[model samples]
Target: MLRFGLVGALGIILAIASPALPAAAQKRFPSSAGELTVDTVASGLEHPWGLAFLPDGRALVTERPGRLRLVETDGKLSRPISGIPSVMARGQGGLLGIALDPEFAQNRLIYLSFSEPRAGGNGTSVARGRLNEQGTALGDVTVIFRQMPTIASNMHFGSRLVFDRTGALFVTVGERYTQRDQAQNPANHLGKIIRIRPDGSVPADNPRKPGWAGEVWSIGHRNVQGAALHPDTGQLWTAEHGARGGDEINTPKAGLNYGWPVITYGVDYSGAKIGEGTAKPGMEQPLFYWDPSIAPSGAAFYTGTAWPQWKNSLFVGALAGGLLTRLSTEGEKVTGEERLLTDIDARIRDVVQGPDGFLYLLTDEEDGKLLRVRPAR
Candidate 1:
């Protein structure tokens, strides 16, 4: 069970220190659909970062300390599955994202993203492996993709994996914090979205120009964490972390410039202005932005039937704000906003819709938990 006393105290401190929203805006938005019932499905996880459900009704969860565990339908976590590649396991850098092969039933393949340590420095790397029939260890593990220009910083490894309907894969990355200026450059993979085939080969129709890296899909991103495919439009949407303010949600198009430091609604940590203003020509604007900075991580477009009114809403996990934010969208624009799970006071790491029509959340803490959300009885 969660330590309510300690968690509550942390929540109070976060509420007092949060500068992103005004006092009035910080007030919880009461759920209009019904009271939410939150249950602790699993606990004692060490900073669980990503989650992926398997074809057999079990799930795979990755810990930031470089271990992966299998979770049963009843929330029982198995012993750490072996055969994962070595990881750097530093601040904000470790095992980050996981995804199952679209044809997992036949191939039993899985993919993982982590901070790989090298002779010079560390960089985000992706690997694929086939799950052995015994379900205890991986077979044929192979490193597939590695981010370019590996740096020494332990921060800003924005690694999230998502597969489009066409069987192509998208990888999100961050501009190593000190290398913010590199976000606008195209020669490297820093601060860019990468598109490639499942086997880590460049797609023939990739939008990179003559001087840009062949895997680049979009440029000028800071550190993108949350990514999801629109349920209707089938476009790729991402949530990016801002420096001080200016947290943004964007639908990244192929070969486009997103304007990270050049144009942002946020400023530096010292409260200095950023860029030449919020708007500029040639750079793409955000579909939605947060002034104070919610520090959004994982996101999913809800299509579940359990919450009928929330069927089409976008659910985003907020770290600094310590809540689950629900945004109602009209086409590409966010029309309304609501915040949930504030009373729990935990930093939400990732959110995903489960196969059973409920929402699952991962809390970012030493004693992280897997929570299931449903309508209160």
Candidate 2:
């Protein structure tokens, strides 16, 4: 682990203190991180959102415009896979997160999170399907879980999916802008982390009681787009986008509230202060945060053998800031942070370590590209 002393760490501490940190501190990152070599492995994507790596080295990516594509190890970008369910491709709602089944070796199954269109409006849903031999067709797609109440507007669709070691699926949903107060409502699924069986059935051990509508694991999130279980501790860590300034990195506790609108490091988009204050007694505080919101999107922990020094660190993608941040951690606490691939100047949507011990990135744009980062030898 590397230590930068108290003076350097003060900037990070002050960012989460409130909304008074300077812009220079917001942009300043670690000065060094060894050699990093980045390459455009695949291109020609349309607003790529989420990504998952297969055991055989293929990559499954979701495009916000309602398409899923496979990128082979040889850098071949395959055609869009068919049989994806219809998506409400509005502002932020559309085809979102993807994850391979924990037992994918035998099942050849994959899970997806997307906006499901309904009579009244659209709601986020989790679907599972099998990948075909050529990776161009989705067979036997099944809807396992769907958000309870569909609503209008398309801003905050906190759709990120990941499976824990137990094979249970964890899905996130945004407030949907229909109801701000619904975030604290255990009866509503909006702005909550839901834990369910692979087939979409509610888990018996969900953080909430049996009478609740769905399996809400945690609540009070504005738009949590990034989520990953810590490699060492098995705890779930999330990165959420704030309205104007507050972007938070938190280790979500079961049944604990994460206070979004009520207490935030951010204000409204029009530059007005949000809620009453930045912290409250009941709400859990963030482990780390950014004042001038980076609009964090995807998250993953580095445990691959290729970069042993990077093991246990967090890799997060920034959409608004257009950078890839590597957060060094000591146990459950973040001690250091470095920004990489800022020269690419693209809205990084997702970051993951590939099967081959390399880093993979998905850019968010009309012609988004898949990038690979390896050690510069």
Candidate 3:
């Protein structure tokens, strides 16, 4: 029953004030470990979705409106960089997940996930490019992977890019709202977590089912928004949206089928039953699930010494709850939960740990903000 720190009787007084407070005001909040300060790093972003820190401490940020910018530690933002491939930018489809190449320091490469336009509609796709030295343009960008059977819907493009320790890239895609049943089919890319090499090739050791799509790592996901490799074990973990309830936290393994519409801890928003039941043989179960969905987006496991008491805590940004949810983890399982940043009152689109051991967050808004959370003086 512990939060991220030592709750020394004043834990109840840690509540924050309104999120409208000026960024320069240096508002502080009490926490079990110590006081936390929330500072605005940058603003004017339109629904910023993903963040990846550069070697020099600057960050590449993506706005869902199909623009990309570089943000500095001091809150200065670069112009929307040139050379981003076109994005659909319709409904939930747009520029989404991003990550640096594991060998970025030597190769200057980066990857981006977006909803690519197709004949029928759009689907999630990943592209790689070299970031120019000045960080002003992406060069030699090429689409490496495109989800199959693009449908005529924009609602469920699960785009989160995470790189495993072995340098394999994991891309999460959702079952297009009208294609829930496709989640159960391994032959298609919808509602699936795909694993691939950095160069768009399938790995030699990837999971294989008879007639399984070579890149499909696991299937039966709804609309996964949060995906991260466990900081300790290197397993891919994800948090996905559900209908009325049934938000799930899963560590997807190779060749496994995580039942979506077939087995959910939820019902349709219209109160109609979904799937056969919550559990069945031959389908993988979530390590943890939420009954009342939180609409989780970004994920990061705190590995910072700044908050020693918070080491290894899994932090998830909630778009629906407008808060940051910290789950205490014991290996692969979530044991306890604490919701923070409630006073911010912003739909947190993505959260990442900075190079300096602090937390950085992107708010999901037209005039979205990049916020820094750190120890207060």
Clashing pairs in 3: none
lDDT of 3: 0.84
**Backbone steric clashes in candidate 2, count:** 0
Q: Residue by residue across 1-377, what tens digits does model 1's lDDT show? A: 00011111111011011111111112222366766656677888999999887766677899999999987766788898999999999999999999888898999999999999987899989999998876789889998899989899899999889998888899999998888899999999999999988899999878969789999999999999999999888899898999887888899999899998899988999999887888789999888888678899999988866566666688888899588877778788877676777776889898887776677788999999887676554
Worst 10 residues of 3 by lDDT: 5-14
Alpha-carbon deviation at 343 in model 1, angstroms: 1.1
TM for every model, in the order presented, reads: 0.91, 0.90, 0.93
Predictions ranked by TM-score, top down?
3, 1, 2
Question: Which RMSD values do the candidates have, in order?
Answer: 8.0, 7.6, 4.6
Misplaced by over 4 Å in model 2 are: 1-31
* Residue-level lDDT for 257 in candidate 3: 87
Q: By the lDDT metric, which is better: model 2 or model 3?
A: 3
- Per lDDT, what order, best first? 3, 1, 2
Tens digits of per-residue lDDT for model 3, 1-377? 12122111211011222232224634676666676778887889999999998878888999998999998656688989999999999999999999999889999999999999988788899999999999999999999999998889989999899988888999999998999999999999999999999999998879978979999999999999998878889888898988988888899999998999899988999999999999899998887777677788999888876666677777888888677777778987788776676667789989888776678889999999988777676
